[model samples]
Target: MSGVKMNNVIKQYGEIQVIHGIDLQIKDGEFCVFVGPSGCGKSTLLRMVAGLEETTSGQMTIGTRDVTTMDPSERGVAMVFQTYALYPHMTVKENMGFGLKMNGHPKSAIEAKVAEASGILKLDEYLDRKPAALSGGQRQRVSIGRAIVRGPEVFLFDEPLSNLDAELRVEMRVEIARLHKEIGATMIYVTHDQVEAMTLADKIVVLRLGRIEQVGSPLDLYRDPDNKFVAGFIGSPAMNFLDATSGEDGVTIQALKMTAPNPIGKTSKAVTAGLRPEHLEIDPAGDALRVDLVETLGGVSFAYLVSDTGEKIVIEERGDEPVSEGQRVGLKFDAKRLYLFDAETEQRLRA
Candidate 1:
């Protein structure tokens, strides 16, 4: 129901610092996701917002309230963690209404709120069942229902689907997305999975080594990444980086055995060329790169390749074309689609 803001927030434990100063804003009724690899401090950052982790320095506010030092119970935020954390002996209805009951709400008020949340989360049929009887997806929905019953100012989910199987993860993603749409509350979710971030986020904050890497809409980060890390981390098959150098006329990609018309020409700086797997095609006529492996995931097939220089490349096979392992091939792609990055800094080289 309210926006969240962090201004120069830092988290440190004695001598070591985990979260470097981070400043970010999540708009009201927005679904914001924090995504990064393990130990990138994504979870630490999420916990700071939830008041689960103490803020060593800086300020955090939910709506107009500065909750930097606020306790979890006082923060006006409800969190759904990776674990369900449900009471095994309590029925789904009791589990959902327990918080309200403890707060001294009348039985009628508790029942009404529990009923409302159950309807929203499609948990009505499981109301009488205990945690032992519910499926993983159903139990997780009950966990979410508990959060919904409180009607907090914001919702926090810390990789709520990590414990589920792939199919259940997909189902819960839809459930969570729908919950957000129905409630229209400010929500912050944390995950190491880029696919979830791409699918569910209105705004994504990419982090690395306790520092914020970049923030933008899912498509914006995928189409125009600020650095090699963002470009690689946002996509499924990921963007391929190859050894390249700039010369008199253009940039030469050693792995592709081709020179592209440089957007910024005539530089002697060494660079890395990035090509998305979807933008390239395997050329059977040329023998510069060899096909190492092909992975076919039904409609989409990926060809893993290695060049004479031993650089690896991954290309999504167009038209689901057949490619054999050990077949020597060449790579073809739009010259304009090529992305250049500084070799040392790994930063994008824009024209």
Candidate 2:
């Protein structure tokens, strides 16, 4: 296992700059995820680390070796791509050990490595089966097993679960998590899915428009984001934002027709107040919210509402009975849970 370091890494196509002076460090044996929306340069950055994309400028290191200009095969990194590129003609065992065989590894060594990888992935039963005979999840496992047999210093996964169905994605997530724990390898994963980032990452690098927005543990970014974008992107259903005018004691939200205490003390400026879906509660005496829709997902429900200001909000509800559309329900939240951001800068207002 090895750590990765990027010092002022920059990538450009002709005169158009995409990645701009990115600096980051991934520790050895850490499960670090690069998460962002499409065209955010997450995949481009990962490709640079894998030696597949040439770094336009800056230095990159895998462990202590400078691999900025190294060949892909000499970078000591194994990449598992979104597509399962297993050979249809080869059996699972042969597919997993193909790299070793191509590299002139002895037949006995290839068999031993394949066996070890299959044991770790629980693919011993399917070793004799070809890629055509395996399910989607099984084929992906074979792809991962192929990477494991190489014993590279770092593992790079570029949306490895995008091809699987929703249920199989969850199952494969558990499998990958278990594999990381058991192997304790340094893994770098890239995905646009925040749910996958929150669940599978030890540390998440949130990127926007080729620059890093934030990097921290999933819960830290969710609970204490540095900006409104990070707050909105880190959580499910996203954080609700409403325009407010700062007052001496607090801010007045015209939409909810309520005054919330301004803990940050930055008054006299236009601000935006944010509330997570799970934080809002339905209270009879609180500000009125007109329910527009309700989504019931088994035990928990989400009530979509529009406040008087025409701002949309979603509130998580838990109970047998849920608020229906057209119902006017009062909404309340803890003062501590409310997030205040500068309307112009979109940065969090701190006390």
Candidate 3:
């Protein structure tokens, strides 16, 4: 295992710069994931680390080696791409051991390495099968096994499970987490899927439009988001945003009244209020809303509603009685659960 360091990394294409200055330190054996929307320069940064793309200006070091200008093969890294790039005609074992053979390892050493990787991946039963005959999940494992045989210092995965079905994706996600634990290798993954980043990462690096937003553990980011974007992007069903304004001694939502923690200053203006769906309760003593749709998912129910001011919100309610559409209901948000942010900067306000 090895640590990765990026010092003032920057990337550009001609005169148009895509990635701004970025500095990060990924510890040895840590599973770090970069997550963001499309065109956020996440993949571009990952490529720079893997030596697949050159850094326009910065220093990249792996372990104790300065590999900023090293070739991809000499960077001591292996990358597993979104598309399972397997040879159509090669058997699983052949594909896994191909890198060793090309590097002039003896036949016995190559065979031993392939056997070991196949065992770890549980591909022993399907080693004779070609890519066409294997399932999508199996093919992805073969891709990972190929990277493992090289014994790279770092492992890079770029949306490795996006092509799988929902259930298969979940299964493969668990498999990847287990593999990381078993191998104890430094791995960096990039994905747009928040679920993948939340479940598989020890630390998540949130990026937006060529610059990093924040870096922290999944739960830390969830419990205390630095801004509205991080809060909305990290959670499922997304956090609800409501326009709020501060009065002489309190804060008020559209048509729904709320109290502030303290007196609001003119400069400490409130613009947006955020709350997660799970924090809302259908209490009789709360603000009233009209239900638009209720989606029952067996274990829990999601109530989609519209406030009197026309703002949409979702509340999680696990109950026996089903809520129907167009039904008027009251909602109580846990006061301690609310988040306030600046409307212009989208930055979170201190509680």
TM-score of each: 0.98, 0.98, 0.96
Q: Tell me the tens digit of each residue's lDDT in model 3 across 75-164.
A: 999999999999998999999999999999999998898898888889999999999999999999999999999999999999999999
Better of 2 and 3 by lDDT: 2
Question: Residues 170-234, candidate 1, lDDT per residue (tens digit)?
Answer: 99999999989999999999999999999999999999999989999999999999999999999
- Which stretches of candidate 3 lie above 4 Å from their native place? 255-257, 260-268, 284-287
Tens digits of per-residue lDDT for model 2, 231-316: 99999989999898776778777778888887777658899899999999887665468989999998999999998878898899
TM-score of 2: 0.98
Superposition TM-score, candidate 3 onto the true structure: 0.96
Candidate 2 Cα outliers beyond 4 Å, as residue runs: none
Sliding window of 10 residues with minimal summed lDDT for model 1: 315-324
Off by over 4 Å in 1: none
Top-down lDDT ranking: 2, 1, 3
TM-score sort, best first: 2, 1, 3
**Which whole-number lDDT from 0 to 100 does residue 88 have in model 1?**
96
lDDT of 1 at 54: 99
RMSD of each: 1.0, 0.9, 1.7
Best by lDDT: 2
